[model samples]
Target: MALPTSPPEPARLAGDNWLANCAEWPDLVRQAWRVEALGTIVTGTRWLAAEAPLVVVLAAMKRIPHAELGPVLADPTVEKGWWLVPLDAADHLSDIRQLRVRPPGWPLRCPPTGWQLCGRFWLQPPDGSGLVTAPPLLGAALGPGGPRLPAEAFG
Candidate 1:
């Protein structure tokens, strides 16, 4: 799904579907970063904060063509931060399930750090409505090497 170049309206997703407000997009991105950082630290991996990958989330009901997503995933313009992947409903659910499972040597559950950890994928809209101009869907963080989808986030 090709999102509009400009931000969309708030009422666009007002139904019972999960939606992330445009205002909170930054926070969501930050949370994803924190999750990545925490994961690396806990696992004893090298902490390369500046070299963190971008998070890509597939938020739409239909899966985005790999041709389209591939380019975005491989895009070199995005140095650091998370980006939406735009997957279909089925794929989104699958991805979420994969993310929820804690990896070996990782914490069983995310700590109460207030920041939504890896397994915690859903983001509540500020107004408790549908998504807004910026919808927080399944995304992956991009770093120097490649895209890092939220995984082993809790641990």
Candidate 2:
């Protein structure tokens, strides 16, 4: 399969979602991820330190109080360092599953739309051919206070 390709402006922070507050801090906003399939952009934050910045952008776009998305956006682990994995499309899919199944820390969810978001991602430098995969370190921050909300809430 071909690598995913997002729209040129996918990372545009002009939406009403939870991350509208990031506009003021263009530097932080620049690191946002453009999820090609989802057609939206999300800031790659390692902890809650980036929350204030993100909240600002989200509030502006959503035209609401940034506080509304606080709890979800306040997750501390998201502030940790990021990994860059290099893998073909097939390997990417496999690695995603391995990340979800092998490690309990994976923030796995099969949304009604049928797409999965590994809230916690793992990565590494490229291999000899400049291809590497970053798999989440399963239980790093997921043991107790991790980001995975209670399953009951979703049910």
Candidate 3:
């Protein structure tokens, strides 16, 4: 798969108006997004990236009250109403890798596993005007269904 040639858009928070406009988003579409979740509710963030424009919808979910979006986002440490930012893919990924190499809890972590660090990614495109199926990995693990979620189920 080819990497997106266009420059990444600036990071932005999907605010209240944004969420209202997307009230029908998840129901109207089913595109998968690649995202990274970090920090606690008061200061946590989610980074969502997709090949096409639907990334905006995923980011919109971040606007919901934590009590509502929390289960889906599934972060326990965070409080409610956390913020979401749409990241500049290339730059964000690069920064994350660099940080992993020198994380604050380095020695204690033993083997630094940067697996949480998202690199390049691709998501299923929206059909003419319908919800997409499961979001699948486009570059490295493209074969069948969407990218496999972790084995453990979210409660």
lDDT of each prediction vs. the true structure? 0.25, 0.24, 0.23
Model 2 residue 145 CA deviation (Å) reads 19
In model 3, where do residues sit more than 4 Å from their true spots? 1-14, 22-74, 77-83, 97-155
TM-score of each: 0.17, 0.16, 0.18
RMSD of candidates 1 onward, in order: 15.5, 17.5, 18.1
User: Which residue pairs in candidate 3 have backbone atoms (N, alpha carbon, C) closer than 3 angstroms, thus clashing?
Assistant: 29-131, 41-78, 41-79, 66-81
Per-residue C-alpha lDDT of model 2 across residues 80-125, encoded as one tens digit per residue: 3322222222233243321221221222111111112333221111
Give the per-residue lDDT digits (tens) of candidate 3, residues 1-155: 22332212321112212222232343221121222321111111223222222333344333333232211121122221111223233333233311111112211100001111122221111111212122221211222232345557553
lDDT of 1 by residue, 1-155 (tens): 11122112442233111222222243453354444422122211211011123233323212332323311111123422222222222233234322321222332111112223333321221122321211123222111233343467757
The true-versus-predicted C-alpha distance at residue 88 of model 1, in Å, is 15
What is the Cα root-mean-square deviation between model 3 and the actual structure?
18.1
Worst 10 residues of 2 by lDDT: 107-116
Q: Candidate 2: which stretches are off by over 4 Å?
A: 1-18, 26-31, 35-70, 73-155
Q: What is the model-wide C-alpha lDDT for candidate 1?
A: 0.25
